[model samples]
Target: MNPVVYTVDLEVRWRDLDAFNHANNASYLGYIEEARVRWFKSLSADWAGETAAPIMAAVQVNYRRPVNWPETVRVELFAERVGNKSLTLGHRILSACDGDVLYCDGHTVLVWVDRGGQSVPLPDAVKAACAG
Candidate 1:
């Protein structure tokens, strides 16, 4: 277990709520995505355009508790393993106020892709940043 390298905060929005007044199941995936994006931006030299941006090959999420609107959501992202072409990032969503965990999750298997979308080995910089 390594310290999370990326932390992103998301404020719950009205649109994020479901009929039950809690964050919808689908919205949880968006929250997870925020953390991953933050992680990539930090680890990659040019995530927005120049360098390769990793793509998700798979995702697994387990919702533990419902989140109501107006709550500040905090997400932490970290990697479990760094392979030649892919890595598994660990994700956690929690309430910023009480620290109640809303979801405990595993990552999307991410592989580096070139501008042409061909799979490539993670760059040395990415490998160093993701190494745990």
Candidate 2:
């Protein structure tokens, strides 16, 4: 796996948990979104156009353990591969300090699209950012 680990620490609120007191499955995707959005923002002047957030063509997530609320959790992201028109992004959820505690793992395929709804090559700026 060409895993590139990117960590994002999220503070769990009471509302983030379900009736069982663990983070809901859907919350994990939200965590991925946080990391992905941050990465895009950090990449200078590349994917940004006149409008719209990046689009996802596909995603795969694996839940390993339950995350309790009021705890600070870390979400780690990595890309398995980068294709001409799409990228395969993987994510691992942890407790930040404790890398051994894995809450889940996920992968997402983000396609480069334009306003006209066509797949384009990921801008050089973004590819460069990922390379580094």
Compose the digit string of candidate 1's lDDT tens values, residues 1-132: 666767888898899988899989889889988777766677665754565667889888877888887888898877777888887787888887767555556566788888789877877766777664
How far in Å is the alpha carbon of 9 misplaced in model 2? 1.0
lDDT score for residue 18 of model 1: 88
Off-target runs (Cα >4 Å) in candidate 1 are 48-51
RMSD of each: 1.9, 1.8
TM-score of 2: 0.90
- What value does the lDDT take at residue 84 in candidate 2? 75
- Candidate 2 residue-wise lDDT, 5-73, digit = tens: 466798877777888999888888888888888777777555657642358988888999899867788
Candidate lDDT values, in order: 0.78, 0.78
User: After aligning candidate 1 to the native by TM-score, how far in Å is the CA of 101 from where it should be?
Assistant: 3.2
Question: Any idea how many clashes model 1 has?
Answer: 0
Worst 10 residues of 1 by lDDT: 44-53
